[model samples]
Target chain A: MVGYLLRRIGMAVLVMFVALSVNFAIPRLMPGDPVEQQLAAVSAAGGQTGDMAEAAAAMRARLGLDRPLAVQYLAFLANSIRFDLGVSVASYPQPVAEIVLAGLPWTIGLLGTATLLSFVVGSLLGAMLAWPRAPKLLKFLALPVVVLSAVPYFILGIVLMALLGILWPVLPVAGGYPFGMVPNADFATALGIAKHGVLPGLSIVLASLGTWAVAMRGMVVGVLGEDYIMLAEAKGLSERRIFLAYGVRNALLPQFTQLALKLGLLVSGAILVEVIFAYPGIGYRLYVAIGQKDVFVVQGIVMLLSLSIALAMLLLDLIYPLIDPRVAARSA
Target chain B: MSALAVRGLCVEFASARGIVRAVQNVSFDLAPGERLGLVGESGSGKTTTALSLLSLIRPPGRIASGEILLDGVDIARATPSALRRMRAARIALVPQGAMNALNPVLTCGAQFADLFAAHGAPGGTARIAKLLASVGLGVEVATLYPHQLSGGMKQRVCIALAIALRPAVIVADEPTSALDVIVQKQILKTLLAVQRDIGAAVVLVGHDMGLMAQFAHRIGVMYAGRLVELAFVRDIFATPRHPYTRMLIDSLPGFGARGVFKGIPGLPPSLLTALPGCSFAPRCPRAGPRCTVEMPQTRILEGGGEVRCHDA
Candidate 1:
């Protein structure tokens, strides 16, 4: 088991390396100079007047944009390994790593809770609906879930904001917490932060719960036909016990892989949700970094997201054997 | 009183095509410690009847009408909680293809332990070890997962699990089908010995009439959702009443007895649409005009046997 985990971790590191290298290369290769654009904006705004060639050269040199691509790639790789992402290009004084760290907790607080909640709710509902005697009401309840799952998260977020925020005025339209509310350095402050995080957290849950419900429903239906479930029934187990112990447990095994993969990919969508809610999260910071062409900030956020995904997948790979001994024995 | 009595049992399924009858008006009584072999071709409703006895049929299949009396208690009308207690504790089933029925994720010991746990029986390491040993498996077998065990070994585990509660009746649905000939004999022997030791009624369902003749005291032949013939094991072999039963016995290739073995010709009838008369009329050599228009009711013979046929 240890050896298998080590192998998976090794593979994940290689994948992360390849991912970050591509992330670094793509922006540099894109047509147009972000520094030049910033300089042109500054000049247009009448902030400064200087020789055009010298100013362009100074801006390029200052941003370290004149170096060879290979040199810059190696330096970025080294810095990435040591968790040293260079200063923000748009916000020159601040370090990228610091900015990302400050915003990460908010994103995790919202998306992470939503992910867990959706999986649990969806999986349970799916199991119930998979029952042969399940009422038509459940099917009716499930139709909306399928429709909602097909709708993009941003659209759902917008609809929810428009309905609940604008029409009903029940929730705050934008922002993670109330204005000027600094996080206190104690448990009470943490509680307060969680309390204020409800609407943004619920927005994510409402958006993603349908997909999980559909996936879990399909999983339960497939599992219901397995030989072991028949055996469970033959053993004279109560319907409820069989549903929970045998049916749900076995059905959820395949979903674990889906859940793990989603956990990693979800960071991308978290940015949009964070923006919608005006949440101070890594995704929000990433959006700002992209707009300002802050290479260092973008690199830091991308690497962090990549590492998180890799770690989650690695954890999932390890967890598979514990849930299913067949995999463990095969690998062993 | 009989150990178990099933009367006027009719199981039907509401399929998209129509209301498909799987088991119709099947009636039988099992004596204490008696082994009854339920013989039939596939889709002849033998397995369906066994499932109906336990009320294990899931929807859209249901027991439209039936009375399953276990030791004079009507199990068909029992509450879910009552049914749960009756199962395994009173009546158990060694399900068809049970070799693949074990939980793949759990160790054999854990699976057995769960069976005991579900029944509120005492489950400890020592009890599990003893149970494993009883089934001709070593203590090490308990630590292994289902995949690690061979087909025969898995079947043995399944048998051990079924008999764990020492129920009054054990319904085995083709228990030896997946096993090799050698393993088949061994499993049958083990099952016979266990049944004898517990003094329980054993209901064995299979297509192989020869195997049934060897173990069962009484044999019930089913054809297309109806019990056509049921007699003492000796009588069933000596004077087979139903043509289907006769064909099934004749088809068994007798060792060193050279005679052209005639396999039963014609397929079983479909149960989706209601048959006006006899289900086996299409295949029966003696089938007449009346056989096509009117269903034959079961008739008790003078010689302690039952046959459902117009000519009988």
Candidate 2:
């Protein structure tokens, strides 16, 4: 088991390295020179019309753009390992790491909870719908959820914003929390965050819940067909126990793998929902970075998301046997 | 009273074409400690017959009509709750496909715990260990999952589970068929040994006539959901009455027994649409005009047992 985990960790490192290298290369491949753009903007801000070429040269040298491509790539690799993404070309003064981290909590707080909530609630409901004598109405629930999953996350976010935010006015339309509200360990502040999150979080959950539920439903139906289920019945296990132990437990195995893969994406937040809600999150920050061609911030966020996904998947694979005895025995 | 008696048991499945009468008017009785082997080809409804005895048939297929009398009560007429009670406690099934018979993710001990708990019986480690030991398995095997065990070992665990509650009847549906020849004999011996200790009447289902001859004191031959003949181990082997039973006995590849190897000709009739006469008519060499036009009634022999044939 220890060896297995070590192997996974090694693979995670290799995966992250490749992802980070791609993150570095993509920005360099972009059309405009962000350093020149920053230089031009900085000179304009200082109200100086002198030495534009010299200023551009100084900016390029300071940002390591004056070095050879190989040396710059090596420097980028080293800086990335230390989480030392340079200052954003769009914001010019703000460090990309600091800016990205500022949005991390909102994304984790809203999208993370929503994503987990969708899996938990969706899987339970899906298992119920797939129950041996499940109600006719329960089977019909797949229709709306399928439709919701079919709608693009952003479109769902927009529709939710329009209906709940504008028409009903039941929840806040934008932002992670109340403006100027300090999110200390107080009921009022937490409630404020949840209230503001309702519309955007609902948008994400609605879109994601359907997919998880649908997947879980299919898995449960398949598990029910297995011969062990027949043997379980022949053994006289009560319907409820069989449903949980024989049906749901085995069915949840694939879902756990899916959940592990989705964890990294959740950290990035549902980009559309975050944008529609104007919620300050990593996804929204990534969007702004792309629009202004803030290469450093984009690279930092991408690297973080990729590293998180790889490491999380490794952890999930390592932890899989603890929950599933079949995998445990096989791995052993 | 018999240990278990099934009367007019009819099982059917609603498929796209129509209802398939899987088991039709099947009636049989098993006395305490008696071993009855149900033998036939695939889709002969042996497995379905075994499953329906405990009301274990699932949707699209049901015991349409039957009286599964155990302890003088009709299990077929039993409610869902009563049927649940009968399962594992009143009667148990050593289901086919032992490898897949167990919950793959559960340890052998956990499975025993489930069966014992359902029957309101004790299932601590010590009791389970003793049960495992009876089947020639070690206590350590209780900790291992199904995948960790070989085919024979899994079958042994299945035997242990069936005897856990010590029900009056233990139905083993093709318990040893999944195993290789050597392992098949070993598993069969384990099943018989465990049956002796538990004192449960055994219902062994299989197509291996030789194995059944070895284990079963009486054998029942089913053809297309109908019990063609059921007689003593001595009678069925020596002087089988039913043409189907005789053919089954004759077809056994025996050592040094030389005759032209005559396999039963033609397929068993489909149960989707009704067969006007005997399902075995097309396959039976002794099939006559009456056999082709009219379904033969079961005849009770003076010696013992019954046969459904025009020329029995």
DockQ (Cα-based) for each candidate: 0.62, 0.74
Worst 10 residues of 2 chain A by lDDT: A323-332
What is the CA-based DockQ of model 2? 0.74
Looking at model 2, the pairs that clash are none
Candidate 1 Cα deviation (angstroms), residue B113: 2.8
Residues A89-163 of candidate 2: C-alpha lDDT, one tens digit per residue: 788798998998899888888877888899998898789878868778877877898788888888888887788
DockQ of 1: 0.62
lDDT of 1: 0.84
Per-residue alpha-carbon lDDT of model 1 for B202-281, expressed as tens digits?
A: 99999888788889999999999999999999998988888888888888897856877778888988899888989889
* Docking level of model 1: medium
Off by over 4 Å in 2: A29-57, A140-142, B256-261
